[model samples]
Target: MRLAAYGLALIAGLAVTGAPNPAPQVTLDRAEAAPGEQVQVRLTGWPTGTVVIELCGSGGPARCARDTSAQIHVPGGGAGGAPLTVSVPPGGCPCQLRVSTLDTRFSVDVPLLVSGAAPPDSGTVRQAATGPPVVVGASVERDRGWPARFGAPARRTVVLRLRNEQAAPAAVALSFRVGRAPSPTGFVAPPAVPDLAPGEERVIRIPVTLPALALGSYEIHGEIVTAGTAHLVVVTTDHHPWGLAGLLALAALTLLPTRRPRRSIGRR
Candidate 1:
């Protein structure tokens, strides 16, 4: 029975560790295009989530039209594709086609050269400069923690600050996860955020429950997806559950205490 218990412990530990996931990728049909031209994009090995694709210029802020951006849904099994068709925004060249999941599970920026774009000067290319309609910033009260705090499981709320930079109101959907990254199917906790007025800012708080004895860092990903762009803020939190695990191990060992060596009075 003791051997069996040890074996089960080993298995349980392995299960908690989990297997590695295949890295997500984005494959573009062409590398360069003229402004107002369409490019096809294929997503492979991406996990299930809602991803936004947009054609954005290279400098200043992301410049893409609300009508040209596309959102794709990757289904179950990590095997999904989206044949995204996006045209290079007029004068938004020397730009990149940006793709990112709502939870930031997969993010890739594919660069492209657009016709009529100013030639490079000293490694600098000029293009239309504009700002994205929406952007986000993230921070937490505590960035690192132990397994427990004052006898309770350590937990924290990630505070997200969002801004609408456009002159018009922007409505955005907020999706976030704070735990093991790129979960096979562990999508949850999509906090609702009110729409922002022009030049308006808002604050959102997402609370996450940290595992008491699970080892490793936790990922705090918050993304705000508007019609034209999806911006993500990725934060990593360090947690040491080793202290709790060690205590548990010690308690288990105490249940089968080691026999003390018999001391002979003659030795004294």
Candidate 2:
């Protein structure tokens, strides 16, 4: 029931911005394999372009073995393409097969099992005893022609809505970045906001600016960092090249002599 409510809330928030484009599908011939062993991976329903496939452990990039990764070029509208062989990284079982676009506008992760991995001990698990629960959601103003490009620059602000549900107060600094993927670059970091009282809600607006010539999908990511824990949020936008079709049609029209009037009759 909780999962369903979360899904409904997410859908409501992004109904205006539209969901991300469909990503390529991935399949592994074998569910479990020993480390350093190669497995056959099948791909299909790929609309187009290139993506990176890598193996990662539980944590973030720090836990991922970067050496065990590959860049796969997917054919346009691929239909059950040839199998791709990828070796399991050094990290043991309980890992993820990660696939993401170069810009990271779209991403998918599949569970991967590697032999000889030790499961987490049930006795050593820590419960959430510190820090208030922060619920974060982000959205772009699509109603005012957001994501606009071609004729007018497509730049907009991302509104971040945060609510603390628990009884504990929170004093955290907010920092974020806009990119194809979340990395250390071009960040809008402000000093820590006033301490948030228990069960308080706050709204923060961060303006996003993209290059005039920039084209393709982008992401707006925000984070609230504190000593006890960190809260992260993300929203998506695009710089759609609406003039591409018009440009192509114009070029074709130029190649046709019949479409031109008799302005050059005197020269002939």
Overlapping backbone residue pairs in candidate 1 total 0
Question: Tens digit of lDDT per residue, candidate 1, span 151-248?
Answer: 34567677777777776556465566667875423333555454567788787787766655545677777666665356767777766656666778
In terms of TM-score, the best-performing candidate is 1
Tell me the whole-model lDDT of each prediction, alpha carbons only.
Answer: 0.63, 0.60
Off by over 4 Å in 1: 1-136, 142-154, 179-185, 210-212, 252-268
Residues 23-86, model 2: lDDT tens digits: 5788887888776677676677665545556676664433444455555556556533333344
The candidate 1 region of ten consecutive residues with least summed lDDT is 123-132
At residue 120, what lDDT does model 1 achieve? 28
**Distance from true location, Cα of 199 in model 2, Å:** 1.2
**Prediction 1 TM-score vs. true:** 0.43
